[model samples]
Target: MGTPFSFDDGTAICLYVINRAPLVEINDEALALHHLSGMGLDPWNPRRMTALRERIHPFGVTLCNNGALSLLTQETQLGWHVPRFISAELAVAQWAREQMGGTEESRNLAEEVEMYLRAWRPHADLIRHPRQRGISGHEHQFDFLQNDELIDVITPHHNATGGLMRKLVDVLNAGDESAPKVRVIVDDRTDPARAGIEMQIIASLAKAMPLSKLLDRVHSGSA
Candidate 1:
């Protein structure tokens, strides 16, 4: 008997009831059949086992070797099923960290940008991280979309902003007349040099509108 093998996909595979019947010792087919029969299942019935696997798939469960079993599910599901496994807040925090690449500073910057946008356009529908299709028919995601504008918040310290900026440019030039106007907000508080580069990229592709300009536009009902 041992702990199951777990995967990041929220699935675990292991011997079933291993404390009593070790998987290695169940060498004979009859023993496997007997073990499955005890659980009210026919070891030879493929359709039944297939149906069972399908039923448990959403819960991240799988069965094998007539006796072995596995459980797979997201962290949220685990927290829900296992009492006191994790607090609701902790689960959400963990999920957010995973989504944001585990960078607290980046997460804070995104939040700041989101808050600013919400305040600026309180009545407009502001979507965070919206997925849209490009000219190539491939889906792409931008940080935020407000009306006819697409906004991205960049951390000056991260060099990946260049690639993201290029993606925005691609989407903008995708021949879609209805494409949103692109804007980027770079936190220039730290690494001002990189922020300058980001600003330049935005300027080259679209208007490198500053935060003040954005606020002004919103106040004047132009955004």
Candidate 2:
């Protein structure tokens, strides 16, 4: 998590991109680079990507490793998806932020992930911070919603997870006969033992998914 370069001017977040086929990023390359963490990228050297190129890990890594965007929306990923008919510039900005993250990043992980999901599936009916009434006639607040799914985001900081289990249990118990599907997006960086125990408690009433796998859950069609 340490910053590797100073003149990076806050660029160089690792991205998973396809290789250029002469004129397009249409094919996947071999695994090579992911630059979010510190290793040995010399900031003052004036030479950057040649070194990054020499160190290229491959497709799962990075090839075109260094550059700046004139505007966030101008950035691209996965080829043909960019500026297709009915294209979304906002989606491109979100993709750019995910790839070339800023120096002063947002601390709101829930909001961040919500935006990520929206960008990837802009046409989906995704609602944020929605309130639904439980069967007990009490209202339950959720971080996100889609169809009948309820997602509650919990973190591993400053007791952020405290009472989440109980609150969710109440919601689950009060759910209707069919019961809406509930998912708890837990921060993956939590302590091992605590996460194990917490996940078990959550699993009894809902799906306990790690923060890192949010998109995976979406892709799996169970988000």
Candidate 3:
């Protein structure tokens, strides 16, 4: 409805990830430390989750929360089965921590959760495909989340690929030197309609930069 957020760089890419666990099923400690203070971890609520998605969209990334990947894969809710393996491990690690008393073993369990979180990092990398970028969640950290650094919002339950693409086109045509390189990451799996919109957006960009010479100087001389 409003202008889509833009980045200074000219790159536009999308990252798609499938969360292995239901939001409620994730580890309590990680959830406690990271979640919205009073909101609880209710990822299924479209209203709450949609607001969260919008806040993080401005960072040159749009995350489709939950199992939207199933749309691309065409398997209904069956899509999350694969990644759930890691999420299950996360649950187990948390369960293990609870079992440990306040001893050296308990300290080790804490370390284990940290390591598990690190392991989950690859999932983002995997989805981003050929590009290198950071993984962000629906809920952001205290700094970005609280400082109002989040740029825009989109509904996670619905396909937001078109919204992402339109923003890119707007940024390119606007010729804003301050615009960041745009990247729209979608799950390898998404509904055909959503994916079709994403393709259309990409086509529009290709049309914009019809020739190498055209793209070479879009903002080359700006300071």
lDDT of each: 0.50, 0.45, 0.29
lDDT of 1 by residue, 1-223 (tens): 2223322222222222212222211111223223323221233458645644454445333445453444333444443432221122123233323333344666566777787788777898998767655554445556678887877765653334544554665566678767667777776665667677768866776555455455566677664
* Regions more than 4 Å wrong, model 2: 1-107, 119-122, 157-159, 190-193, 215-223
Off by over 4 Å in 3: 1-159, 177-179, 190-197, 206-223
**Pairs in clash, predicted candidate 1:** 10-73, 60-72
Query: lDDT tens string, model 3, 97-202?
Result: 2222112332333243333322433232221112211122232211001111111211122223333333344434544345333322222233445544544555
Q: Which stretches of candidate 1 lie over 4 Å from their true place?
A: 1-103, 209-223
Backbone Cα, N, C clashes tallied per candidate? 2, 10, 22
Error of 3 at 25 (Å): 44
All candidates in order of lDDT, best leading: 1, 2, 3
TM-score, predicted candidate 1 vs. hidden true structure: 0.48
lDDT of 2: 0.45
Cα shift from native, residue 170, model 2 (Å): 2.0
Candidate 2 vs. true structure, TM-score: 0.44
Candidate achieving the largest lDDT: 1
